[model samples]
Every structure is written in structure tokens, then in C-alpha cells.
Target: MTVRIVTDSSCDLSADDIERHRITVVPLTIRFGDREFVDGRDLPAERFYEMMANSDRLPSTAAPAPGAFETAFRELAAGGADAIVCVNLSFALSATGESAQAAARSLTGEVDVRVVDSGKVSAGLGLMVKAAATAAEGGHSATEIETQLAELKDRVLIYGVLDTLENLKKGGRIGAAQALLGSALSIKPCLDLTSGTVQEAGKQRTRGKARAWLAKKATEVGELEHLAVAHGAADDIDSFVAGLGDTPARHPTTVTLIGPVVGTHAGPGVIALAMVPAT
Candidate 1:
């Protein structure tokens, strides 16, 4: 059966990447006071960050309705796709996974839709989506694609340094990284994706040191099969990516702007690194 790929906006894959891989993306909703904007559709990342920087209120996120996923599945099924593999952000972090599964169940005998919890967020999740898309485009069966995705999820690593803790503080909710508080603004916290939730990786006294440590953390994972440098409108990102040692001979690094979903909590000026271990 012909297979297609689907993912939520939180995966952090750009429009170009999605189109290039023929992947379907479902957007999450972002609420700013009285108004709400669709993650990637209505509010672009640049404008969202700009508003974030100027506003004192912390924006909230809501998972897409199950109907959204069902619509996407129905459309793709109508377009001649025999199956769809949907990879979403971690369930530990958001309800997007639950929404996807509900939609999958609703389409029971009609469309073959499989929802996968990446156990990751941001580009870490993006890597798996890309892997699934690549596998499907190569004629891999649905079963084969699912098996590859399961393996890839465990090998993914994500590291990020938030520019401010206010986003987390203002959001009034943090899973297990509560200890990140009680420190002054002088401390920059480095976080990693662990067991589906954001956790404190370490702390740096300055953005400069945090950047270096983030680069160093990537090397600890050994050679990478895929590596991406992501940021929230940070100008030093190019320079920061350059400091990440040397990319493996044939593997060039990918640079993408982090979208609204992940960018909301990571905040503006956040720089991140996501990679998959070499096979």
C-alpha cells in the first residue's frame, strides 16, 4: 500500500522540509489573551517572537481538535494514499499525541492512520518525522516504517538553552524541571529532552558558555547520522553552529528557525541542537 507521513507543528520541521518529503503537518493553536492563532498557519514564528518579546502576558497552547487530524487523514486517503504514519510531540509535554490517537481511532476501517509519540519535542521529534517520511518515500511498508521510527526515537538527543526563565515561570507549569527556578537571571539553564519531558541538563553563567556547552554535548553522543541546529531568531546561530566541531564528511548540518509551539516555552534567543546517533 502507498504510505504517507504526518506530523504536528511541534516537530519543528520547516515548510520546505515538509514539502520536500511530502509530509502532512497538523497545526496546534496558540492563545494570546483574547485572540488565538494557529501555530504555523496564522502566526508566523518571527511575528510571534516579536509579540512575545513585547508582551508581559505568557501565551498558552492548545492541542488541535481530533477533527483536524481526521480531516487530514480523510483528505490524504482521498488523494490516493493507502496509509499514513503520524509522528507527534511527546505526550509527556502536550496533549497533541492524545488528539492524534483519537482521530486515528475515529477513522478505524476507512483510512489506515498510525499515531506515534516521538517521546521528543522540537527538532528531536523532527528527526523521526523526517526518517519516517524518507522511509515511506523509499517504498518501505507501513510495518517497516513503524519499526524504523521506534528505533530512531530512542537514538534521538535534544539540547537547548533558554534565554529566559520567565516563560516557564509565567506559564505557571513545569513538569519535572521545577528546580530550574530560584536562580537569578544571570544563570542560563541548559535543558535536554528526557523521558518525554523537558529536564535540566546543566547551567551556564553566560550565553557564550551555554552555546559552547550545547555544542560539546552533541559530541558526547558520538558520530551523528543527522544533526540540526535550531534557534528562535538568534543572530549568532550561524556562528554557534560553526563552533560545533566539524560535521561528518558527508553529513552537513541543517539550520532551521524554531516555530511558535516549541519557541513559546524555550523563549526568544533560545538556541538548540538535535541529533541522531550514528548507526
Candidate 2:
């Protein structure tokens, strides 16, 4: 039986990668005040960040409705796919996983659907989705592919530095005490997603210092199989990668502009590092 892979917009897969792997993507929704746009279709990453900078209202994101997933699944199944593995962003961060599972229940018995909560987001989740697609293309069965992805998912690490605490406060991520403390010292908080929820890992006084800190953390984890640098509109990718020293030599890296769904909460000048351990 032929198997297919599915993921949501939060995976951050590039357009070329999606087409190359024949992977199906369902978009999440983004809200900027009264206006709403589909994550990838209506707002490209570049335009998303541009609108974010100029808009008075901070952008917010929501998972796609179950109908969206249903439509994608039906189309793929019609094309001779006997099974599907739907991977999504962390359940703790969004409802994308729940919606995928609900949509799977409506599929015909000929197509077996399995929903996986990646417990990570952005390129971290992208790494797992890519691995699954590769496995499926190699003729791995649905059960074997799921097992491999689950094991690899735990080894992925993501760390990011937010330019302002204002965005965090606006997103309801911190309390008055933390925000006040951050402001008093000009502290920039470094964040990580361990299981699914974002948590404080450390802090720095400047963007330069934060970039250095993330690079050091990335190296200490282990040998990286895949590494990525994602940034908001205001971040300097060249400086950020250069700070990693020989780390990039050991592992190839890809750089992508952060989209509004992620940038909305992270705000401008956000830089994130995604690393997966070598197998």
C-alpha cells in the first residue's frame, strides 16, 4: 500500500521541499485585527513580517478547521494513497494536532491516518516531517515510519531569543513581575521548547550576547545532523551564523525568514536555532 505524509503550516517546510517530497500541507490562519489570512497562501513569510512591522495590532494565529485537513486527506487518498501520517506542531502550543485527528476519523477505511504531535515547532517540527517523508519515499510501512519519527523527534532542540518582552507580555506569556525585571536590566530572554511548552533557558543584555549564548548551547548538546537558523525581519543572519564558529562546518545549516504566525509572538529581531542529533 502506498503511504503519504501530511503536515501543517507550522512545520515551516519550504515550498520546494514540499513539492519535491510530494508532501501535503494544510495552512493555519492568521489574524491581524479584523482581517484574517491563511498562513502560507495569503501571507508569504516576507510579506507577513512586513505587515507585522507596520500594523497597529499584533498578529495572532489559529489552527485550521477540521474541514481543511479533511479536504487535503481526501485529495491525497483519491490519488492512490492507502495511508497517511499527519504530523503537526506541538499540542501544547496549538490545536492543530486535535484538528488533524478529528479529520482522520472521517476518512474511508481504505486510508489509515495517524496523527503525531511533534512536541516542537517551526524547523524543529520540519525536521521530523522531512524525515517521515523520506522514510515513506523509501517504501517504509506506516508503522515503521511512525516509529522512526517518534524516536528522532526527542533529539531535536530549538532555542530562540526574543528582542522585546513587550510581545511576550502582549501574548500573555509573562507576568508583570517578569516583564518588569526584564526591563530593569535590558535583559533579552532565551527560550526553548523542551516537551511542548516554551520555557526560559537563559538571558543576555544584547543581541550579540544572545547569539553567542545560543551558539554555545547548540554545540554542547551533541553532534548535529541538521541545523537551521530562523529569524524575524530585523535579525542579521550573517552575524548570527558567523558567531557559531566551526559549528556550521560540522553540520550544514539552512536559514529561513520567520513567518507571521511565529513572529507575532516572538516579535522582531527574533533568532531561533534548530538542531537535531546525529543518528
Candidate 3:
């Protein structure tokens, strides 16, 4: 059976990569108080970042409706795709995976639709989607792709340095780590995606120090398979990326913008690095 891959916008795969692999992306919604915009569709990344800078209120994200996934699955099946593997953002962090699963259940025997949760967000999740799409293009079966993703998920590593905790608190996503960044004092919080949720991994007194710590994560991830830098309006992204050393030359690397979904909780001036060990 010819397998196809589907993912949500939180994966943060570039438009070029999506087009090249024929990967379908369902966008999550981002809201600013009373206004709602479809992530990457109604609100362009540039415009979202601009509004975030200008607005006093923090934004929120909503999972895509089940109908969206249903439409995508029916289209792929009609196009001769015998099977589809839908990868999605972490279920622990968002309900996007549940939505995909609901859609898959509705299709039943019409076409094989399997959903897999990467237990990751942004670039980390994007890497798995890209891999699955490439595997599907290479004629791998949906079952095979699913099995590979299961093992691949554990090897992925993601780290971030939040410029402020206002967004996390405002979004109500701040969990145990809220104790560290709950104050208004000037503090740079270093975080990593742990068990599908943002958690405090380290603490730095200043933004520069936090960024340096984030760069060090790449060097620490020995024998890399995929590496990427995720950011949201960080002015020094170039320099921070440079500190990552030559890991980019050794493995496939990308610089992805932290889109609205993750951006809402991460806030502006956030820079993150994700690396996966060779599998």
C-alpha cells in the first residue's frame, strides 16, 4: 500500500520541505484575546510576531477540528494513497493528537489511517514528520513507518531559553517550573521539552547566559541524526546558532520559527535547539 504522511503546523516543517515530500499540514488556531487566527494561514508568522510585540495580552492556541483531518485523509485516499500515517504534536501538551485519532476512527475500513504522537513539539516533532514522509515516499508501509517513529521518539532532544515567563503563566501552561519564573524580576529561564511538556532544565541569571547554555545542548548531544534551531523574534539567532558549532555539517539541520502554537506559551524572544541522536 502506498503510504502518505500528515502532520499539524506545530511540527514547524518548512514550506519547501512540505511541498517536496507532499506532506499535509493541519494548522492549529492562535487567539489574541477576542481575535482568533488560523496558525500560519490567517496569521502569517511575520504578522503574528509583530502583533505579539505590539500587544499587551498573551495569545492562546486551539487544536484543529476533527473535520480538518477527515478531509485530508479522504483526499489522500482518493488520490490513490492506500494508507496514511498521521503524526501529531504531543498529546500531553495539546489535544491535536486526539483530534487526529478521532478522525482516523471515523474512516474505519475505507482507508488505513494510523495516527502517531511524537511526544514533541516544534522542530523536534517536525523531524519525525519529515522522516516519516521521506520513508513513505521511499515506499515504506504505514506500519513500518509507525514502528520506526516509536523508537525514534525517545532519541529526540529539545531545549529552549525563554526570555520571559509572562506568556507561560498567561497561557496557564506553566506547571511545576512556575516557581522559578513566576516573578517579574529579570530572569532568563532555560527549558527543555520533557515528557511532552515544557519543563525547567536549567536557570541563568541573564539572557546571554541562558542562550549560551542552549547552544551547549547541541554539543552535548553526541552522534546526531537531526538538529535544528527554533526561535521567536530573537534578534541574536545568528550568533546563537553559530555557537552550536559544526553539528549542522555532520547532520541535517534547520532553523525553524517557533510558530504561534508554541509561541503563545513560549512568548517572544525565545530561542530553542532540538537534536536527535542517529538511530
Show model 3 residue runs off by greater than 4 Å. Answer: 182-184
Least well predicted 10-residue stretch by lDDT in candidate 3: 243-252
Candidate 3 structure quality by residue, lDDT tens digits, 79-99: 999999999998888899999
TM-score of each: 0.96, 0.93, 0.96
lDDT of 2 by residue, 1-279 (tens): 688999998877789989999999999988989999998898998888788778888878888899999999989889988889999988877888999989998885757998998998888888889999999999998999889988887888888887876666677644323634446348878888656677777878887888788888778876778888888876577877777767633457887777667777778888888888676
lDDT of candidate 1 over 99-204, digit per residue (tens): 9999999999998888988898888888889889989989998889989988888888888888888776666435667787867377988888746777888889
Residue 229, candidate 1: C-alpha displacement in angstroms: 0.9
Give candidate 1 misplaced runs (Cα > 4 Å). Answer: none
Residue 70's lDDT within candidate 3 is 96
Model 3 clashing residue pairs (backbone)? none
Relative to the true structure, how large is the alpha-carbon lDDT of every model?
0.86, 0.82, 0.86
Best by lDDT: 3
What CA root-mean-square deviation does each model show from the true structure? 1.4, 2.3, 1.4
How much does candidate 1 score in TM-score? Answer: 0.96
> What would the C-alpha RMSD of candidate 3 be, to one decimal place?
1.4
Residue 249 shift from truth in candidate 1, angstroms: 6.4
